[model samples]
Every structure is written in C-alpha cells, then in structure tokens.
Target: VNQNEHTPTGTIREFVALSVRSINFVMNAFAWIIALALLALALYLLYRWGTANYDYFEQRRVPYVLPFSAYGRMLTGRLHPVDAAGEGYRVFPEERFSGFFVFRQPGYLIHDPELIKQITIKDFDHFVDHSFNISPELDPFLGRSLFFES
Candidate 1:
C-alpha cells in the first residue's frame, strides 16, 4: 500500500489532541509556580509575626516626676505630649501612663504613672496646650479641647 493510501483518518484529530495536551501541561505548571510563590509569602509573614519583639513597655516599671513642658514629659518616663495627642483615646482610655515612643530616637519609651497622672488630671495648667498646632480656620470642626483637637 502507498504511504498516502495507508494514512489514518484520525491523524488530524490526534494532532489537535496533542496540541491541547501540551497547552494544558504548560498551564498546570504555571499555576503550580504561582501557588508556591503565594505559599512562600504567607510563610515569611508568619515567621515575622512569631519572631518579632513587642516588649516596649513591660520591661521597666518605676515612679518618676516629669518636668512641666509639652516635650519634657518624655524625659521623665512620660510619653511626649505630641505623641500622646496623636493617640487620642487609644492610649490610657480609663487610666494614666500609656507607653509611647519618640520618633527617630533611641531609648525614648516612657512608662511612668505619677507624671502621667499629673499631666492628665492634677496639673493641667502647665500642659494645657497641645504640642500639635492646627489652625481652626482650616478645619472648623476641630474641637476646642486641648486633648481632642487636631
């Protein structure tokens, strides 16, 4: 028989099937690579969460008197007035002496209770104004209270 005469009728169908199989193989490989990358990212985040240290306040506990200035409280175990103002009600919602850090400064974490109490309740005269200055003309809705104003 001649080669042309002996050729199978299913030759075109076999070629189409082979092409589809190759395309599916490439797609499955690509999908597996993407899934592996996502898994790696998730593992890295879990490792960071497990190993990171967050003991900024629990290490030290002492009673100290702070100076009478907006920024001086940071020096005497009390958080900076500016940092405290930014936190609003988040810090010390029901109590005094919340932990805070000075920006770009080392060994600037504060955790004294007495000084914080004075600044918050007893001697409000010295620390009456906020360290942050916001013009009321820009934001008319700003509260007049020193603690809540922007």
Candidate 2:
C-alpha cells in the first residue's frame, strides 16, 4: 500500500472526529442560547416581583410616600431609620394612614396613635405575621428576631 493512500479505518476515524467537533459546536451554541434565555427570564421575573404591588396605595386611595425616598435611602445607609420614618411621616401629616413598601411588601404607616393602638391591640392577631425577612447566615441576631416570628 502507498503511504499517501487513505485506509478505510483511517477515513472512518477522521470522519468520526469531524462529526464530534460539529456536534460539540452545535451543543455549545445551544447551551449558550439556553443560558441567555434563562438569564433574561430571571431578570424579567425579578422586575415583576419588585414592582408587582407598586399601585397598592393608588388602588386603596391612601396617601403614598414614594418608597424610593425613605425606604430606599435607609437601605443604602444614606439615611437613618429615624430620619426615614420622619420623612415618611412628614409626607402625609394630614392622612390618618399611608401606604408604603419595605422592598416589595406592602405596609401601612398609621399617622394616628388610635389606629396604631387598634392594630396592635384589637387586631393584634390579624397583623401578627409580617413580611420582613432577613437571612440568618447574614445576621444571626436580627435575622432570628421577632420581626419574622411568623
């Protein structure tokens, strides 16, 4: 046999190698497409969850203090909790209660002491469960606090 002549087995092996490379290329492309699609879906879902109840106050006709001002400021550590509460309180001084959000959870800030007493005393059981959340791993003390008792 001439050295330059291709044997049947050699030709088969070369063809198999080329086929594997093509399959790998296609699979890689498909994987990337799937990954990108998943990323986009996750982002969209997050956006939806973040703003799902943004119209809570508007629907209830309650005064809304733009959460981005006080809550957002507190989250970023740019404003103290007292300052944030003060700002929220000032926004609707006349309203008996106002709707706000602590990250996506709806909350009502009762401007009247009577309403606060009613919620804390008469309707205490109804309002026991709160949506505040904290990771135990991140903050053992606060995460395990009464805020998330329910």
Q: Across residues 1-150, which tens digit of lDDT does each residue of candidate 2 receive?
A: 786789998899889999999999999999999999999999999988888888888898888778778777787999897766556588888878887776777777788999988887788787666767778888888888755643
TM-score of decoy 2 = 0.55
Summed backbone clashes in each candidate are 0, 0
Clashing pairs for model 1 are none
Report the lDDT tens digits of candidate 1 across residue range 6-109. 35656776788999999999999999999999999999998666434334344565221221232455567577565554452354455344444343221322
Best by TM-score: 2
- Give the range of the ten consecutive residues with the poorest summed lDDT in model 2: 81-90
- Poorly placed runs, candidate 1 (over 4 Å): 1-16, 39-113, 121-142
- Predicted structure with the largest lDDT when compared to the true one: 2
lDDT of 1: 0.54
Kindly report which residue pairs in candidate 2 clash with one another.
none
- CA RMSD of each candidate after superposition: 12.5, 7.1
